[model samples]
Target chain A: MHTRTLAELGDALAAGEMSSEELTRHFLTRIEALDPRLNAFITVTGEAALEAARAADRERAAGRAGPLTGLPIAHKDIFCTDGFRTSCGSRMLDNFISPYDATVVRRLKSAGMVMLGKTNMDEFAMGSSNETSFYGPVRNPWDLDKVPGGSSGGSAAAVAARLTPAATGTDTGGSIRQPAALTGTTGLKPTYGRVSRYGMIAFASSLDQAGTITASACDAALLLEAMAGHDPRDSTSVDAPVERYADGLDRSLEGFRVGVVEEFFDEGLYPASAAAIETALDVLRSLGASVKRVSLPNLALSVPAYYVVAPAECSSNLSRFDGIRFGYRAENPRDLADLYKRSRGEGFGAEVKRRIMTGTYVLSAGYYDAYYLKAQRVRQLIAEDFRAAFAEVDLIAGPTAPTPAFDIGAKTDDPVTMYLNDIYTIGVNLAGLPGVSVPCGFADDLPVGLQLIANHFEEGRLLNVAHMFQQETEWHLRMPGGEFA
Target chain B: MALTRRQVESIANLARLQINEDEIPAYVRNLSRIIDFVDQLEGAGTEHVHPMAHPLNMSQPLRADEVTESDDRARFQANAAAVEAGLYLVPKVIE
Candidate 1:
């Protein structure tokens, strides 16, 4: 039961083979036994999960079950849940019990999914490795010594370990896809504004997007179908029709034009991982996809531009954490200025503070045009490059990460070196295009992910392409045990 | 491209973050390297290009000017550090 994909689990529940309560208990038991090994979960709402499962069983008995009814899933600690504490992996929000549910949480609950718990993440979703998490780093299930890439590391680890069938994650510059790559999970970051951002804690307002980490593209399609749509609460949420993504999964990939980015296979990628990506492209070719060599000339500038733009936006967004209203407050403040300073300095982790200061510097009086404005223009060039490339191809493909997961403490000393981990994935976010990282093969006994990017609002076409690849390959089904041994 | 220590201190103040004296050196070092790294953006030819603030180039959406949410002061105040008489308390400003 624990090994089954979300789609398989839903089918079992629909066939009356097992009750939702029974299925929820099965996962809860696995979480109790395995979660300590990975530190994937920050909070486990077992009692609430049982209660929700019972309700789902009652709904199924009443003949009103949805496709997601009774399925258990975890949420990255970023989303606000009414009763559960939404920590956002920060000491500042460690004690915050939100007054309402994030739109993503509300939608999934209405679809009858059971909440297993809130998974851990990098503090304020800032770091590439999970080491920056306040709840401690989530170790890769495949190898205990390596990181499960972050800031969506907890969700990726949880899904990879089969602690939960699926988990929700937010991507801002590869948070979802990078971690998914390391953990051998299927991760999707939909086009910006595709999923409403209401009640999900803000990281980088323009770049942030809610997505999923699941066992297969099929499960991602199911979740995306339920979660995608406009909500008036989030002004940026696109007022576009949400497609029935699952219905498009079985579409043939014949005549599909795949453009492999020439820059993605540059010196940054490891030889083994590059080989894995090449082999995966062959599988796509065998399925009748015509491979074309393409180049997004401005893609290399993504990291530097993202560092400027994301921090600039985050510094503004995170200003709400000032001591007076909510979040952490310094004790015995001598004045208002001290209250604000000490509260933020003490509350935020080092990486978060570094970003806040970086933003403050770039957007400062003398440097705004030199740094912030310059970065924004480069971002435009990168987006324009993607537009040009997509006109000639139906999809773009590349490696998700440079290599497999690395040691936890390897890149923490140098922030720039750490930021480059998302070299292949960040360009998609800069352009607001949807992208997914699906397991392709293993390198050094650890998993490598093949990233697929689509033009804006092409999530259905992207998922269909991925589902067809998954049909021809069993890479997504392999678990993380032999490597552990 | 490296930021001076004084600049780092001023930036922290602008961001309203209290950095202890001992932590200043590390901040100066890390912040300098990051700034140097991002300075590569200056090389790109952005002279005639329009800057993109939004990803989709969409303008902010406006809504009808009506009271959309009911008063939930008590519920919201529960998360505040100190609240009295239905108002958030802060350090006194004027003498």
Candidate 2:
């Protein structure tokens, strides 16, 4: 049951081959036995999951089943799940139970899907590696010593290890794609506002968007179809029609023009990873997609601009955790200001604190013009560069990460080096475009990913191209030989 | 662009985070490194570019100002650290 994708699991439920209870139980048991090895989950809602699964079985029995009926999936702890804890991988919310379900959680639950649990993530989705998670880092399923790329690492790890067939992830500057690349899972970040952000915790609200991680593009498509739609509560939610993502998976890719970002192939990329991406491009060509080298020259500017913009927004967004509301509060305080300082100081982890301070510095009165406003202008240049490139091609392709997963502590000493992990993935978010990472092949016996990016809201075409390449390659099917496997 | 320890401390103070005295140096180092790294943006000329606040240049969507929500303050405040009679408890701002 854990091996089957959501689609196959749905089919089995419809065919009465297994009840949702049994399937949910199987995954719950796997998580219990396997998650300690990965720390992939922050909380497991076994009892609630079983109850939901039983209800799904009843739905199927009554001929009221949907495509996602009886399928169990993990929600990243960032999303608010009414009766469960939504930790967002930070101690600030460690004891905070959400009062309402995030829009994504509600939609999936409505489709008769059972929530297995909430997977861990970097605190407030800030770090490149899961190491910053207040719960402790999620280890890569491929190799225990290697870090799972983050802040969506736990979701990628959970899906890759088949702990749950799929999970939700949020990407602000490659949180979804980088981890998916490093852990060898399929991850997608839809266009900005394609999925409602009403209840997902804000981390750089403009750059933050909810996405999906799964074993294959087909499964990602399946989950995204259920999660995508406008919400009145989310002011930025796109008031456009949601694509039938799964239905578009079989679209033919004949004569598709794939723009290969020439800048992404420069010296920083690892050779073997480059080789794997080249092979994946050939597979796309075999499917009748032609590759052309297109440049988004302003690509180099995104990381710096993002460092400014993301933190600035986060500093403002996180101000709500001032020891007065739903999050952690100090036991006692000398004064109101002391209460605010102590509560936040003890509640948040290091990376989050550093970002808060960085944001504070950038948005400070004297520095605002030099950092915040300046970065926003550079952000415009980056977006315009993408708009220009999209005019010449239907999609863009590149290596998801410069290299495969690094050893857990390899780059942690220097924050800048750690930030570079998202070098290829951040530009997509800066431009508010949709992108997906598909397992292409392995480098140094570790998985490599080919990132496919499309213009705003072209997720159907992007998924179709990925599905076509995946049909010709078996990389996505290669399960890790970690403890669970 | 290397920030002094005094400056780092002041930044943390402004952010309402109490950094331990021993951890202050690392923050200074890391923050300085980050500032220096992002200094790369200084080279990009954007004299005429408009600073973007939204992606895709979409203006803020406007809708009629009307109450569409029923009161849920009680349910919403259920997760608060402290509350009394439907009011969130906080350190007194006035004596």
CAPRI accuracy category, model 1 = high
Candidate 2 per-residue C-alpha lDDT over A1-485 given as tens digits, one digit per residue, 9 for 90 to 100: 67777788888888889999999999999999999999999999999999999999888888899899989999999999997788899999988889899999999999989999999899999998999999998999999999989999999999989999999999999999999999988999999999999999999999999999998899889888889988989989998998888898988888899999999998999999999999999998899988999998988888999999999999999999987878888887988889999999999998999899999999998899899999999999999999999999999998999999999989889989999889999989988999999999999989999999999999999999989888999899888885767
lDDT by residue (tens digit), candidate 1, A242-265? 999999998888889999999998
Model 1 segments more than 4 A misplaced:
A482-485
Supply the TM-score for candidate 1.
0.99
- Residue pairs with colliding backbones in model 1 are none
Query: Rounded to one decimal, what is candidate 1's iRMSD?
Result: 0.8
